[model samples]
Target chain A: MVLASGSMALATRTERTPSLIGSVWRSTVGKKAVMAVTGVIMLAYLVAHMLGNLKVFFGAGEFNHYGAWIRTIGEPFLHHKWFLWIARVVLGSAVVLHGVAAFQLSRRDLAARPAKYAHARRRASYATRTMRWGGVILALFIVWHILDLTTLTVNPNAEEGRPYENLVASFDRPPVTALYIVAMLALGLHIRHGFWSAAQTLGANSPRRDRLFKVLANALALLLTCGFIAVPVGVMTGVVS
Target chain B: MNLTLRIWRQRTADAAGAMTSYEVSGISEDMSFLEMLDHLNEELILAGDEPVAFDHDCREGICGACGMVINGQAHGPERTTTCQLHMRHFADGDTVDVEPWRAAAFPVVKDLVVDRSAFDRVIGSGGYVSVPTGSAPEAHATPVPKPVADLAFEHAECIGCGACVAACPNGSAMLFTSAKVVHLNALPQGAPERESRVLGMVGAMDAEGFGGCTNTGECATACPKGIPLQSIATMNREFLRASLRGGRGA
Candidate 1:
């Protein structure tokens, strides 16, 4: 018995160890973990971005200064606008990873059940069902957002380095404001489900704590939605102008 | 009462399957779903046609042997097993479409029957205690807290039916695996093998081609035994702990 057990141990030790990271990426559970981590990273950025947008309420002087401050972050140690570039890199990577994981998992799910159900009924919520479409809308919105605000390419009245003028110009148009509002609604729904899902996937949910997590998820979704829409509403209502 | 049935017919696993409609008369409202199918099968046999095949045992909903997607819902429109669903849920002149559990891992064996041995393999990986055959131990030898015992029992109610897989859009098996893991790991006797059990079972689940849980909560809703969605969350916690402890080098 001892000899057999020793041989088993020796065999295990001699076997080529699989790459841990590669295995995790391949497994469904591992992909879920990746989604949860990347989702949390994006959620954190949203909160920070929302807070930064709130600076507009303080007037153009403070708002534009805030934008300039972001560029000058880590000054003396870092070159001009280096911090902003670094943030873009980090946020960009997180977005790509989150999107890739979601897309691959969705494909796997579809492949798992090739045949369509004849009388399928939904047992999940509206937000859960619309997650895939909401994600697509948000992705498209991000591109339009960057083009309108950062690049000044889509903004009809493009102003160089004038953050407040650019902001007002973008939201001044009814079509642009309408599109932003719609995208924010999708973002709200996405966050509503994604927040709680991230908690479940990351192993933070418990029977006792489930209610608390749900409440927190709703509050975060509401806050981010209102926060983002407040800026466009402010411009449309002439509050910020 | 008369009912129209659109049942999927297939000869073998590799054979193509399609919906074939049939009409049945004099199916009593009191008859269970399977009994109604039996009536249909009896008619088919008398007409010199192959009887429709389906899986069932105990006819009482305990064995988890009966499963099918009825009218786009797993186990019909009711929140119970197909065996427990009675024909009274349907109205006269109603048409019902029945198909086997549609999943890549669960291929149709014939008509309404699909292979469910994937679940067995998952359980085989690590779903039981390693107790040897011997005399039973004293009842009071291992005291269990009432709340813990109740939670474990609630999870233990899972019948290993493939409804969760059928109801899920992604055909994920998280709910089934979670039920098994939580039932055993929550018990004192199952403590020693907790980490290994979770790691092995999760590995087996992925190997079976099941999708990851997106927290859609459909599995819990479609579950006949009323297994709560919290079980999946609990299992996630267990898996995270096991992985952190270097199980399977995860």
Candidate 2:
């Protein structure tokens, strides 16, 4: 009986650790924490990814070389196939987590009626509303991006091209370049709210640093957006072709 | 100062909402914003009309119960809660736009009163110390740095007012939730459950139906306690560390 009971106890202990997640979800601000933490991860990925993408301005050879370099960064942990798969997994999880949390929050905000008012105020920004729409845009861009370059696939409806010379062919068309620019712009909008907001969610607010964050956030958003737009615009304007 | 008021009126939640304008004449710059609201209610009552519904308690600004969008800004332009906001912040003949805190999580319970129970649910999930009954511990059982204590106190200043949520672009309550996390978890007493607390609070925040923080820094501006937006950053770091550790079986 003692032996049997000990085995049961061990089984219960295994069940205990997972409850930590449940506990946090039940916490006062656990839900927001999940979004904030996950957001920071995605933000990091975005910065790194955008920097790598800038290779497009270097011409087909340099751009493709950069793509090859990206396909190699995971070296020890990721081969070409493995890296793509891993990125898909990690990035996909982040997207799912962020979406689920956002939807839930929206519903709650809508339901908190009756005896409301008390704190009615409107102090949000344009980036705030645009975030919801931006997410949708970016999702489509990602899928299209993979097919157009990574898989060397083209859309049946808009097959005005190929992704030749390190994916330079991908930018040869005005419409394609325009789409890339638009997607990057949307990404910029998403990041503007993301960078500083994530920090605040983590509880790092200080008066001086907060101001710094705002400027940095704005600067980063502008840089990435303008930079991304500049590249595609250059390609479309025959500056890169 | 005379003010033009754009108040949102609805007979009930089931009723469609509308923006109604009223001319509130006679100005007292010394009156608290809510007091001015009270005068408006009195006038409405005399006319046999339903007084506007807005949330306010303790009239002193700490409760965070009073929130209204005045002139398109949350809690008016004084960087103070509506209760503490006085008429002096206004000029004569100013048109004041009054509306309930707009958010999905903060539903309109009546006119101005929103159902902030989502916050309570977030709290109930784990915004507190799971203390067991015991004899009081020594006050100085643990010596804490003054800075840390001060920060904790500053964060604790949050009275669960929905102002930040209302002020957020994404309608996020990250400021409020992060404040709660930073307020209690800063102390040594809060250490044992630090990971659990942060993790729990963040998860509860998500589950309660609040938007994610896309930090426009507006929530901090609207916070009655003036909770800085960095608290959200701190909580994010904590949650990440805790999750990584937990994934590693730490």
TM-score leader: 1
Deviating ranges (above 4 Å) for candidate 1 = A1-20, A74-82, A157-160, B248-250
Predicted candidate 2 versus true structure: per-residue lDDT over A1-241, tens digit per residue:
9999999889877323445477445443455567777777787786776687676676666665555565566778766657767877888898788778766655554453223443344435777667767878988888898787666568433332323252456677768877888888888878788767665656555666878877887888888787667766666677776
The DockQ figures for the candidates are: 0.63, 0.28
* Chain A (alone) TM-scores for all candidate structures: 0.93, 0.75
TM-score of chain B of 1: 0.98
- Give Cα distance to truth, residue B41, candidate 2, Å: 3.1
Deviation (Å) of B177 in candidate 2: 2.2
Candidate 1 residue lDDT tens string, B1-250 = 9999999999998999889999999999999999999999999999999999999998888989998889988898899999999999999999999999988889889989999999999999889888878999999999999998998999889998899999888889999999999999999988887977887898899889887788998888899999988788888888777766656422
TM-score of 2: 0.74
Off by over 4 Å in 2: A1-128, A150-172, A197-241, B10-18, B53-55, B104-107, B115-121, B129-138, B169-171, B203-207, B241-250
